[model samples]
Target: MWSLPASFLLLLLLLLLGQAPPSRPQSLGTMKLRLVGPGSKPEEGRLEVLHQGQWGTVCDDDFALQEATVACRQLGFEAALTWAHSAKYGPGEGPIWLDNVRCAGTESSLDQCGSNGWGVSDCSHSEDVGVVCQPQRQRGYLSERVSNALGPQGRRLEEVRLKPILASAKRRSPVTEGAVEVKYEGHWRQVCDQGWTRNNSRVVCGMLGFPSEAPVDSHYYRKVWNSKMEDPKSRLKSLTKKNSFWIHRVNCLGTEPHMANCQVQVAPAQGKLRPACPGGMHTVVSCVAGPRFRPPKAKPGHKESRAEQEMKVRLRSGAQVGEGRVEVLMNRQWGTVCDHGWNLISASVVCRQLGFGSAREALFGAQLGQALGPIHLSEVRCRGYEQTLSECPSLEGSQNGCQHENDAAVRCNIPNMGFQNQVRLAGGRSPEEGVVEVQVEVNGVQRWGAVCSDHWGLNEAMVACRQLGLGFANHAIKDTWYWQGTPGAGEVVMSGVRCSGTEMALQQCQRHGPVHCSHGTGRFSAGVSCTDSAPDLVMNAQLVQETAYLEDRPLSQLYCAHEENCLSQSADHMNWPYGHRRLLRFSSQIHNLGRADFRPKTGRHSWIWHQCHRPRL
Candidate 1:
């Protein structure tokens, strides 16, 4: 006779009593899909589906672009950029609902796609599929609205829980190093390390909010457990003695986010002659903690510094400037913030301080990689109008239960400034001024390459500046040889870019026919300096009237000014500045109010004099 585990039977009995385990809400004809985990957007995330009132995931087997298209369309996107396999976006919880899903690219909903029977999957959440949808093409805030409208609700996720024993002051946090455990039927049970792999360790680490996993000392844990099991006088009984066995023989692909997402094989009922860990012991894992937020600790009777009191903030370890893990200088030391309630509102404050527009994403779980030292804040509550993070309210004494693994991060929105990502500036002290670098894709790999300076002009530089989120091009330089150690020291793949000065990106400009350069290295590459503001050439009207008059000056004196094209034709071989009717003479001075020096394109000698309009009474 076939028999299922007692826990499985209990789950079924609960369902029959109309007490289904907690689940996300459901709507007719629409299955909820969301992109979660680090570095994700609304259009991309680990794929989970609502089946039989429970939120579950699909197996990556036979998952393809076609399957992704259905998911994207359902979420109001036009198409998908790509699909990911093996829980790339982090593992999902609940049952591995669907397996061997085969979509024909024309299915309106994933339920209509052919698949294996529901809840009968031979796969686990470690094989969970993910999709990256194409960016929204709709105008206004429709994309944001659609994403919110389709967000998951009533979500009850399973987690890889940890219990600490003999914690050390220096390396300990609430959810850091401890015995790895999972919950079943409302009781916690430890996993045996008999066949545990590093892949299993990776999943557990991610579930705890660490970006990646590190090597764990299983031997030390084994020795500790062996000592406890051998001690008869010890009051601590083995977990097997408690009749609690949640998971056994976990097998993972190293990318799952939670332990419930891993594959498990049940063991036979325990007996006096048999033990849960007959020859092995419970699994113990020590994950590298990310950044931590610690409360401000001041010396006895000392006050906080003015800078520290005012709540200054900064970002670090981002791919580009003005984006990364958020940190605040508190108590004269930089510390990280917790992600307990991190959202776009709190992220906006950090972005504004960094001179960016707003927060693009409020990344959590040490998304940008963990930072070192104490964490200073947690449960940050902001209304999106605060000037700084310190001004936001946080839960009192919330850092007690927070862990470094749950560090918060952010990606701020740089003002688009009519620019593209393919172009970048380097060599200057700031991001606004630097040698021009273009990203070139070769053999499916992107490499930053230099643009040949030959024929490079202001028009081309304008596009580069706007693309870099800088305001305007101040100087378009042909040779940056004077500047030391150019950025992107890569190969020169393009030359002679011709821009119309209104182009949004350098790629939109016309490329020169061939490459020619006396200096070949990127150090001598073309560069540009951009500024937020530009100077205007204003006419000094007051000075103009005071300097010159119709006094019939000598042609010799006027000849120099005339030769230089600084005067009207009345001084052209005339005996003197006389009998020049309707000719108004005045000296004009131009003052530049911009950041750079101003130079007139046309000489003064080319000036044409004309009579001013006046009303005759």
Candidate 2:
């Protein structure tokens, strides 16, 4: 206690020793510059920094902007930044390589940084160019060092997240079956037999809300029937032929068949054919012939079964109870009618459209739940006479209330009409109106035959054209030529083809041709005459006129098949055609020459006419 001053001095010395030495302010140096190339070896090219006196490559795994910012700060720069590359920075020639350097934002230096080992590349080296501690200066500082680091050569910092890459890699896996469950409302449920069909595995998968091709394991269940099932062969022959007579199979667990286990309904009349059996089993047996089939006799003293008698009467009268008609309430509105005054005749029409048996009875006043719209018609009469419901005039303008509370309803009993059959057309029948030509094939040789003019009426021609799939429309009359006698000996006598003020001769008409046709007028005259040998003479005349016109022009270019053939008798006869005739002739000669020298066999020639010209002869 007497040495208090000495004790205080000793404590101060101890405290001084415990405290750390002052760091030299890190020398306050500017950040270094580095460039990373794709080919640079991670362990070699990496720059070594005096961070805690230990060297390590920056890990390139999961590098981010925040990490880069911290790195730039540690480098003595205003903002810590990073650059990533996949290619060598100017082809880093030396052995120094830092392939993948992942760094946390707090890394003190490029060398002393935590990473996913050395060579793991979070970013490609080709894109990397880095700057270390960069010197900071006020506006007046003029240091060459700062100038050198401020341009394009400076490192660029990029921010990127690596979690997305990891997530993408995790998503590549094969799909499996049955492990997934479907949720309905609040509960998840497994697929049971309720809605499954054996014919299609897809149906089961779809009902369970899974992919149609989902894998399934084998499953089986027992079938049961509980009704008085009649054996197929034991039923009446007539009844067995009917589709309604067949019994359907069912599945069950108990020895006795239950109604729920049965897949189809069983008929009562056929019940007497066999006894009720457990499991709903059926056996095949020959049907026994009996008296002409009749309904089973009712026991005596039963309320004189008015139902059966009423059914018979309805059947006899052919009245339908459920049949109805639809009418257009207005322009586009449609509504149904009630069978208030419906009878057998009207019932027949409705039943026919509905594809049912003849009318049994017509019901009135909302039998079908509700009326769709306004009642378009009222007093209805059907004698089974009209082709369509719209043809029934008696129902036209019948007053019916539009109160929207009641519907006009009718019922008609109808016999079931099966599917319609195909329509057949008679041979050689045209589906349109035109001339009827019949061909008779004898020994497989086609012979020119007589045209059956008698069947050439419009209706007959239409039928014929329809048969051959051709369109029929009226063609203009041009010319008329009559031939007397047979083909080889026939003599043409052109006569009796008339032309009205607006009508043109068939031979001269642009719409048709130079063939035989009758005009609108009563008088007939032939526009032109020619033998069969000169059938196209009219067209030839037009071609000749074009050629003659070319020859008569001056300053014309002429083309010929050959140089020697250029001066044809026809061309030599032309008057005053010149200026480029030789050139044209040479071209024509070359073109007409054999395929040897000229690539194409044709050429064009322009002609200017100096003299007025008339139509060529």
Candidate with best TM-score: 1
Q: Tell me the whole-model lDDT of each prediction, alpha carbons only.
A: 0.63, 0.29
Model 2 weakest 10-residue run by lDDT: 529-538
Tens-place lDDT per residue, model 2, 59-94, is: 333445555555555433455334442322332332
List runs of model 1 lying over 4 Å from the truth: 1-30, 35-46, 50-54, 72-92, 106-127, 130-310, 353-355, 396-401, 421-617
The Cα error of candidate 1 at residue 481, in Å, is: 18
Please give the distance, in angstroms, between residue 168's alpha carbon in candidate 1 and its true position after superposition: 64
Model 2 ranges with Cα > 4 A deviation: 1-330, 338-340, 395-406, 410-617
Q: Write the per-residue lDDT of candidate 1 for residues 150-233, one digit (tens) a residue.
A: 211311123346667545622443345677776543556677777888778755664454433467677777677768877976
